[model samples]
Target: MSEQQGRQRVDVTLSINGKSYTRHVEPRRLLADFIRHDVGMKATHIGCEHGVCGVCTVRIDGRTARSCLHFAVALQGHEIETVEGLSADGRLERLQQAFHEEHALQCGFCTPAVLLTAEEFLAENPSPSDSDIRAALSNNLCRCTGYTNIVKAIARASGREGEAASSGTGDAS
Candidate 1:
């Protein structure tokens, strides 16, 4: 029975990326809006606001999903990971470096979300072919003509050796 200026405040707990977060939120707040505004994570961009653009993609539990498609209220006590959480020890992970080495970004607007989505896809299917990667990312839309490098980036991150060479997390390259 808590209240804010006008909206009721409900307790919400979420594990973002790898950290745990607990906060009070308005029921009507969209997850993307809440993440951007409250969490202060600028990486979660909103493009279509409609599920068309995967700019607001995040990982919930272990799967990639659109943050704009759900409400904060519905995500209470859920595990959510944004692009900001993709890094390890403040250093960009292997897939991220792969993006850089493979030149997977243009304009940089969609890179963060695309990175997270690619991470999820690769974690599930390490040996995904170009077409398989394409199918996995069918829901995401990138107009940068960077998908070629992006796909290569995923492939690079999929291998333990490549991941270590790029990620530097000691996975053994």
Candidate 2:
């Protein structure tokens, strides 16, 4: 067996959702695996081990990505933010509220990733159009939600249908 493929001892610290976790892990342990197993953050789901589905998505240092695609060893000392980190005092964020009000989910499989990605997107854009939302989230695939309510939810979150239609065409501000 390869060195990193089997269980081996390694110590690291991870800042997740604004909390710190110092633990030992195996080299083969995936970031998603570690996030769920060690830190007990269950929101980061594994949809595709190959990184196609965005269900395993999380924000590592403010950029969203497939947690399954990254290794735990690579996350040392880096700030990780799972979908669970976005709330305050157990209440949902504004984007999440928008999602709920707009009925932006079904089956709830891809909801976490969608929400995280949407969170970062809206923070940067804060006002994106439908096409803009689609383009920003093109990599994420949702079998439920039909990408319609999700789109509308983002638009609603931004407070503008016109905002939802704006491309990443201009400078972000």
User: Using lDDT as the measure, which candidate wins?
Assistant: 2
In angstroms, how far off is 143's CA in candidate 2? 0.8
Worst 10 residues of 2 by lDDT: 164-173
Question: How do the residues 136-172 of candidate 2 rate in per-residue lDDT, one tens digit apiece?
Answer: 7787878765677778778887876534234323221
**Poorly placed runs, candidate 2 (over 4 Å):** 2-5, 89-92, 161-173
Error of 2 at 29 (Å): 0.8
Please give the lDDT score for candidate 2. Answer: 0.78
lDDT of 1: 0.73
Give the least accurate 10-residue stretch of model 1, judged by summed lDDT: 164-173
Best of the candidates, TM-score: 2
- Using all chains and alpha carbons, the TM-scores for the candidates as numbered come to 0.79, 0.85
